[model samples]
Target chain A: MSALLEVRDLTVRLRVGGSDREVITGTTLEIAEGEAMGLVGESGSGKSMTAKAIARLLPAGAGVEGSVHFAGTDVLALSGADLRRHRAKVAVVFQDPRAHINPVRRIEDFMTESLRTLEDVPRAQARTRAADALEEVGIDDPARRLRQFPHELSGGMLQRVMIATALLSRPLLLLADECTTALDVTTQAEVMAILDDLRRDRGLSMLFITHDLELAGAVCDRTSVMYAGQVVETSAADRLHADPLHPYSAALVQARPDVTSTAERLVAIPGRPVSAFEAPSGCRFAPRCPHALDSCRSTEQVLTGLDAGRVRCERAATLRGRLLDPTESPTESEETADA
Target chain B: MPDADGPVLSVSGLRKVFGTQVAVDDMSFDLAPGRSLAIVGESGSGKTTVARMVVGLERPTAGTIVACGRDRSRPARNAGERTRRGREVQIVFQDPYSSLDPRQSGAAAVDEVLRVHHDHDAATRRRIVGELADLVGLDSRQMSALPRALSGGQRQRVAIARALATEPKVLILDESVAALDVSIQAQVLNVLADIRDERGISYVLISHDLAVVRQLTEDVLVMQRGVVVERGRTTDVLDEPQHPYTQRLRASVPGPGWKPTRTLRRPA
Candidate 1:
């Protein structure tokens, strides 16, 4: 099966204080046709950059070096009108709906503009199509919603509008960047349901970026864990949850709050993710990893397995017990347990 | 419902209004010392408004807030006297990045509190900020860096450290961990738990995530449009939610086991 979108050795740089700073470091992945891939990491781990790069929407200060191929076309090679049209192939849904939807514009305009570039329908037809899209996404009173301002609608409704707009273009690929994080859980679940239904029906491939592991597990078929802008591991969501191959991925699993688990206290990763500018020497997560050893500090690893989507972490296999390291506790770590 | 141990903070029939819109109405809950009470609500349900009122940011149109046996304590009004109330209840905001003044460095920001609130001189203030930063897992080197330089987790940790500067009795976290990454969310939640155990500080944790609330808080309060819809043990509310709103909230948590292909019927 051919991939809907394949990204190769993507590296993005930006000028910071007279020196170039690398945002994405040799990041690579692919989204299969009609598949969902979850890109997850802490902030500044280059998740959003990868999405922006795919959309060809990097800001003016950014410099890029990589190849993103979609539908038999080298995305980077597209020129003039071709590039703009190619850019529309993969639509992006941002973290906050307010950020993407114009606060000044009405719902009617947002829906119309989304389709204007992608389709050549009559104005009356477009309005009817917009109302239909809104209804399809489960918006109540679709006609009333069209005239309302962005602020007048709930965050969930605004997001529905964003999704409705994305679907208006009928793109094969969609990029949702923490799009549900800002919403309440009830609304998030509703939005998730809509996305799941839409994907199956429309055969939409998604590159879903979030810092939430639970959400990734629930919504994604496969997940790629990133740390310091590198894809640490990518595997089936359930497999990753059960047996994470990378040290960072393992820690994230233990940290997720599960309703089934009766653990007395929530486990916390001891240290913060490494600074993006000063990437960790060997493994990006080595400094904070409980399984970190002398061998991990000197040897850098890369993606080694295509069969099961495994990582090159030298300590991953042998570091099993220490992955959670039940005994090891940072000094102030226990003070909160009793609370 | 009042208990034998007595509540450090108690609210009853709390109501708030913005013109014709009732942001919060008839909210009631009790916070015991060293205990954490999670307030879970949907957006526009008045969870933050309740917190703001408890912290005295907004005056309550009705109801009473009794703190440490005083029927109602004076709210934080001006910069000069705000520190006095800061010792009673300190609030941790959602966005740590914007919460701090951009002009001041991390250390300088923490030190400012010490200088103004703690009545410490420049030298002492700097030292105190170093201790605070270290307490929240931040290094002294980060003291000179601006808020923009730190990661989301680090910035939020800085916010936590600043909240602890006055040694507040009740720490009110309003979507404190919501903006953080999942891994960082657990880390910060741990920090909050540690603070409560070490200092016997009570917490008024406000969130919309039921799983997170169940993990950290023992007691829970479910709010709907400012009204206390349900109140009980966190496990009780999560495991067997009695209120319709509470049940819906619990069902709403997205996880691998549950298929994200069903939507609950809209509230009638």
Candidate 2:
């Protein structure tokens, strides 16, 4: 089957205060119908920007190149009523519900506003549909909840309300950008379970964005790791930890503290993460990668297919088995060094 | 300094009530010198309340907190006493952004702490500030940069350095690494471990992440609604939890091959 959402060689540049910075460069990925794709990255990795690009939510004066296609429609080329229709087809749930939602509005007003204004549904019909959507997300006493203000609900409840409102449009692609990052673990589990059930039951597609690799691994079918505004690796989510292709991916797998076991010291990646503007000339991760060769510093690497997966590292084949080994040092890989 | 052989920090029957509601009740723990203890719980579980009570931010209605062989159960009687108490215990908060002043550079923040707590000369204060920054793996560029110019991890390092400037015997990490990314979290955790090994300082860690708790602390306490449900060695308690709440919490964490199951209701 053809992919539902396709982004090809997409590059985004932000112009703020007379300065330009490339936030995303050459990002490419596809989401099949009903497939949940995980976009995993640290801060400044541009995972959120890619979602915004697809949703047409980029800040004013931001320059966009390449193409974002959804169901054979050019998202970047959409305008006027067509853009509004396209937006209705895609919904975004942010990290914080309180910030996105209006504090003074009652739950019913907020939930039904989209349906009432955009689709011109009757107020009574919109309220009924909103109640049903709330019920579907596991909220009890939906009628009572609809009358309550935003502050009356807890964080988890507010998040559920946001999800319910997002579903009122019946969007095909859901952009969940760190939706659970601010929640408690148990609450996060509940929200995640609700989303998982909703997606599976409705056959909806999702672009799940999170910094937690383990979370993405558990929830998504395929995962794409981003670094410094580029896609570094793409593979089946379950295989990411066991068999990571890029050195950066391997380092990320090793950097986390394991709950089941204890290591003498966590294998922390040296140097802090950089934004795309500050990324080096060649490979973005070479500054911190332990297995980085001299060639990696000067030669630009491109994403290539390997073992039914894709990676952006040229030395992926040579460094295959040793990537996860904690004791593998930078100098230890000198056998492959040209100098 | 107090007796080196005894616990660096001790609490007994800690209780706090806001009007009619009891936020924390009958909570007690001790931090042995050169050791770390974690208080793990979900939101409103009173873990943060326990930290606040220990740090003198909240006055306990009942129970006593003894730090460095002195009763700190009540707020300090004078400014001098408060400064002295600060030297005994310090805390690092969750958000690095708000905890730091936007206008002050990292080195200035550390220097300000040193000036308030100690009688060091200008040269000595500068030297100590540089030493503290280096101890947290912050370079000179980060040291001179303001909080906004630095990353979240860099800001947190500056916060850690400021906390260490007081040379406190016990440090309370109140969800210190929760706001950071995974890579940066690992870096900060390593810095904390190195500090513990080098200075032999005790730690009272308040957190909800089990993986972080397991990595940093030796002992763990599982709390629910201000009550201690389970407490034991970190590995043993996490590996084989006896309390239903603790079991549910462990099951909630997502890991390799882990799946989130819907509970019957939201736990009270």
Number of the top candidate by lDDT? Answer: 2
Indicate the residue-level lDDT of A8 in model 1. Answer: 87
* Candidate 1 positional error at A2, Å: 2.3
lDDT of 1 at A98: 90
Each candidate: how many clashes? 4, 0
Note the residue pairs that clash in candidate 2: none
| Per-model TM values vs. the true structure | 0.90, 0.97
In model 1, which runs have C-alpha deviations exceeding 4 angstroms? Answer: A259-262, A320-339, B1-5, B73-83, B103-134, B143-149, B264-268
Q: Write model 1 residue lDDT over A36-153, tens digit each, in one string.
A: 9999898888999999989988887888887999997998777887877776678889979898778898899888984665566777888888988888888878899999999999
State the weakest 10-residue window (summed lDDT) of model 2 chain A.
A330-339
Tens-digit lDDT track of model 2 for A128-206: 9999999888898899999999999999999999999999999999999999998989889989998898898888899
Kindly state the number of residue pairs that clash in model 2: 0
Model 1, residue A289: distance off in Å is 1.8
**Mind sharing the TM-score for model 1?**
0.90
- What would the per-residue lDDT of candidate 1 be over residues B1-268, giving only the tens digit for each residue? 2343788898888888999999988877778888989998988889999899888889888888877655553454566556566567789999987898777777777776666567777777777777777667788777677888877888888888888887777889998988877778888877777777778988888988777787778898888876788989888778899999888888777666876645633212
